[model samples]
Target: MSKVEIYDTTLRDGTQAENFNLQLEDKLKIAQKLDEIGVDYIEGGWPGSNPKDIHFFSRIKNYHFKKAQIVAFGSTHHPQKIPQTDPNLKTLIEAKTEVVTIFGKSWDLHVKDALRISLERNLEIISDSLAYLRSHVKKLFYDAEHFFDGFKDNPEYALATIKKAIEAGADCIIFCDTNGGTLPFELETIISQVKSKFPNISWGIHAHNDAGTAVANSLMAVHLGATQVQGTINGVGERCGNADLCSIIPALKLKMGIDCVTDEQLAKLTSVSRYITELLNIAHPPYLPYVGRSAFAHKGGVHVSAVKRNPQTYEHIPPQKVGNIRRILISELSGKSTILSKAKEWGIDLESEDPEVQKILQELKDLENQGFQFDVAEESFKLRIYKARGELKKHYFRLLTYRVHDYNTLDGRPIAEAEVWVEVKGRERHAISLGMGPVNALDRALRNALEEFYPRLKEMSLIDYRVRVLPETSGTEAKVRVLIESRDKECVWRTVGVSHDILEASLQALLDSIVYKLFLDERREKC
Candidate 1:
């Protein structure tokens, strides 16, 4: 199999996503996770741009990545500015990265318009910066910014820009589908021409999703002999977004027989992708290939039956390879396989052909036909399954009363005070605490209350938390929804809590987090 390099720009590009940003420490944590997951290159950030990014490279030195090279991303050295004085160029030197990637204009329109520079100066910007950066970093990647449009508009100029970078000793010349509007056929043809024009130059592909064709264009680029792939994990970036590395690396590995990422750590890819999203406080892309929760989930009866008969009948790849598993969801359209699968996932030991399976499926269908959606709330789904088979444990933490105080303030800065009383293991206990936020206060009080009875609860903290407000109406009367995530040293679990009162919604989720931990503990004790 051919080897294609996978460069993940999640920290640089993915952070620009809407409501998605990571602090310097968060970036380092995610960078380490990416390294553990075995990516080739990690684009840390444009150190020339943000203070957090500038601090990231320095602080990240406290740790080292084994399987990935940390790459610093920035624009080409400013036109006519001396390389030493240019902050952009200096940032590259300061970042201390082994690889430095800089982009220059390939399109004349950008030269005359955005840069307001002459055409010849643009070529100088490309080659001169690459040559200078080559003297500094071990590897230099030159992104032909807007290369596809440049090729389509002026093929000669685009080819000239790349040839100039090739002459300057760039390790790779990456074609940028910046607008992401190029069809696969057009992208393949343009790339093939570039390959032929610069036969000796190692080529790369970086595509966007403006037209929702980023993944397809990147795949086509690989098919046409591009040796490197540049993208963000989960397809996050400015505007529409960039190509997704999560999809690209697997497509290169499983689909195209290319070894783009580290070999043995493919299973960690799913958790790595998910961990980045969780740290960024963004939801994982639902349909992301190989890593999404719904990637191989089956809801249709025909699909479930076929999957049971022969997994290849419906699955594209085995789900186990990436720390993920196929989910047969129970819905109105679910079959007995769906029920059987859910039973198994919930640890119930019912025969696949048991008549009770059909009855449970019908029951789930009837419930779903009303307003129940078990797929999103698996805790409740487990409860239903356990109850149907007479396997439910009694409630662990029975809520006695919970209260919220709005008047906890020191010198006028107000914070929430939470008081929670619960019946735990047949004993009544009370806990009270204050926090910067209502949910935090509730979580702290609950954990404090249960520490004596459930000491393991002290080790468990809310590592990744989320809140989703689903608006069904306008203004004040809207029904609000909340989702909270809590994790400890080992694993993570999410609980959904919804109410008109935001405090109540958060409290409900906080309650579920404690109960789920206790429930799992009781199960372990039984085992």
Candidate 2:
């Protein structure tokens, strides 16, 4: 099997994305995770550009990585200065990383316009920069920035720039699709031509997603004998982002028969992807390939039925191979197979011929018609099954009454206070709390009233709350659906509610969130 090197640039190029910023601590944590997944290189950041990156390099020295070599990214020496005196080159060495990667102008257009240097001078800097860093670092990589576009405009000059870096003792020459407009076929042709010229030199690929084909171009380069693939986790980078290593790694190992990551390292892929997004406070895109939430999720009745018989009927690869599970979505479109499959997953033994399956199916459709979407809130769907099967015998707590008062103080700050009365184990408990909104007040009040009886509820807190107004009705009278995402130490669950009043809808979802947590704890206790 062919071997491919995975170089992660999430800490560097990925931070260039709009609204995507990371602290020094966050970079170190992500680098540790990348190391755990067995990536070949981790580009920490451009130390010459930012103090946070400088701190990341210094602090990261406290711990050691097992497999990944920390890399410092910079540019070729300034046209006005020699490599030995250039501050950028100085910072790269001072970063004390095992590997150093510097990008140089390969496009004559960039040389004349961006760098304002002659083509010959740009080639000279590329050679001088690599030769200076080659002795300072264990491995040195030359990123021919805009190599594809340069090759298209002037193939001879582009190949000449690469030849300079190779002759200067650079370990690898990475062809960068800096503008990300190169198509896969164009990339394949250009790389093929370059390989013919430099047959014995190691080659790498750094592609962007402007043309929506970064992953394709990276894979094509690897197929054409490029050994190194550079990308970011979840493809987070500037513009449309760089090639997604999340997609590339699985394709190389599971699809392309390349030995990049072991099965154990592959299983950590999904968790690692989500962990970075979570730390960045970004919602994990459910549509991402391989490691996304919906990657292996089956929803259509026909798809679900076929997947139950054989997952290969609808899925290309086993989701478990990438550390993702096959999800059977519940909705009006779900067949009895979907319900039985979900029930089986929840450890409930149910047959296709079970009368309760039809009952649950009808209830699901009826609720969906009432603007209740169980697909995103599977915990609510699970409760529906439990109720249909009479497994949920009694209520954990019953709401007696609730009232919310809203007013503005003299300082012109609006505040809401809620008083909640509930019966737990036949004892009435009442609590009052203030919050930023009426719904928040109600959530706080209710939790305050119940936390004494079930302290485990304190472990669970609402992470995300979304309200959607049903389009069937318009204006202030429209029905609303509330989806609440809650999490404890073990796992996260989403529950949904719908009502004519937004506050009532929020209350219903909140109740389901607490009830689900209580039910899970009770079930675990029984086991």
Candidate 3:
């Protein structure tokens, strides 16, 4: 089998997603990352549509890509304009990318309704557009927009459109599921018909997720001998999103025995998925396949036991193959093997028959019953293990008391103030600080009091804090769970706390965050 080419359109089609905007610097950074991951092409953007994209094309020229070619995307010439003078085609040439992709109307419905041109005129537009750019760009691709729907509506016209493009020197013909309504079987039948007519031509598949079959359809296209796969990282695109290359790339390389990317490049898949989401400031969906946080996590006792003996019992592939780690979740459903696996992961020695394992298991169940979730708070669970083994003997600081106050200014701004008292190594300290909210003020005040005793505490800061109201209660009496994500220069960790009072819950999580940091530092020093 031939190696499939990966064309990443995250900077182009991906930006069309709501709230998925990226600055020029972000695009540049992502382009570098895409090149590092060995994508064949990076669709920069439509330079003619937006000033930002134009600036991106200009700025990207400074960086040298080792593997990927930067691609400029645009549309066919307008019916009223000549291809040589069309602004869209002119801008595609000016972008100076080695490769260019332009979409043309394939569906006769679009020719009549969208373009409002005669059928022959649209075909002329496709032929003229590709011919004009073929000489200017080193490689040209024709995206047959709505190709499958067009084929179903008028097979002859659809075939004619691509026929003109091929004759005009298009290097590849990409069949796009523009409306994302094509299913796997439907795509299979259409592509089979199309390929039989043009077996020698290079074919690619571009799918959308409206029908929730984008990845399935893409794989089907590959199974039928399509040599190129176009998608975005994490599937960020207009509407439901494009096919997720994060899932497709691994499936091709690992499952289908295709060498689309080298092993080292494939291992960077998880981090690249996360890096794009982090830059977009969107929460990465933990349930996403392959690279998601929960993709390889196990919670059932039976499943954990089997996986401990052999990961293949429950997992489809090794989590480390995609730069993801296997997670043993601490929950009521977990058994002794789960605890033992988690302990081994954290470098703690424990036998299967250890009594402390059962003790820790019961403690986890009791705490989870009280709204304390340990699955997302592995640091808190690790602390529990240390306490169970009587290893957490050192107390860095003892909290004496804390208070928070909120006030409204005449200017309509709200102010929060917190005062904290703590005792450390026979010495006492008191500090007060103002912050954006009660939780923020409390975190500041506590750090102010403790940073003097443990200077390294200044290095760690809270990155994310989320509050959830437990459904077991309601109204003002409802219990709240606070999850705090903290990070130092080294790594990030999560801790959880639950209380009827939101402030108390926040403080419990904050305390765990600080203690986890201190514990890590001590462990590192001892090592």
- Top TM-score model: 3
State the displacement of the C-alpha of residue 171, model 3, in Å, after optimal TM-score superposition.
1.4
lDDT of 2 by residue, 1-527 (tens): 35789999999999999889998889989999998788999999999998998898899889888888889999999899998899999999999988899999889999999888888998899999898888899999989999999999999999999999999999989999999999999998888899889889998999999999999999999889889999999999998999999999999998899989889999999999999999989899999999999999999899999998888999999998888989999888998888888888888999888899999999999999999999899999898899888988898999999999998989999999999999999899999999999988998998899999999888888899999999999999899999999999888899999999988999999999899999999887321
Candidate 1 clashing pairs, residues 3+ apart or interchain: none
Write down the TM-score for model 1: 0.80
Candidate with better TM-score, 1 vs 3: 3
lDDT tens digits by residue: candidate 1, 64-167: 77878989999888876966678898888889999999999999889999999998988887877888888898999989999999988899998899889989
Off by over 4 Å in 2: 525-527
Model 3 worst lDDT run, 10 consecutive residues: 518-527
- Choose the strongest candidate by lDDT: 3
RMSD of 1: 4.5
Looking at candidate 1, what is the lDDT of residue 120?
Answer: 91
Predicted candidate 3: what Cα RMSD to the true structure?
1.7
Q: Per-prediction TM-score, please?
A: 0.80, 0.95, 0.96
RMSD to native for every prediction? 4.5, 2.0, 1.7
Residue 203 of model 2: what lDDT? 89
lDDT of each: 0.80, 0.92, 0.93
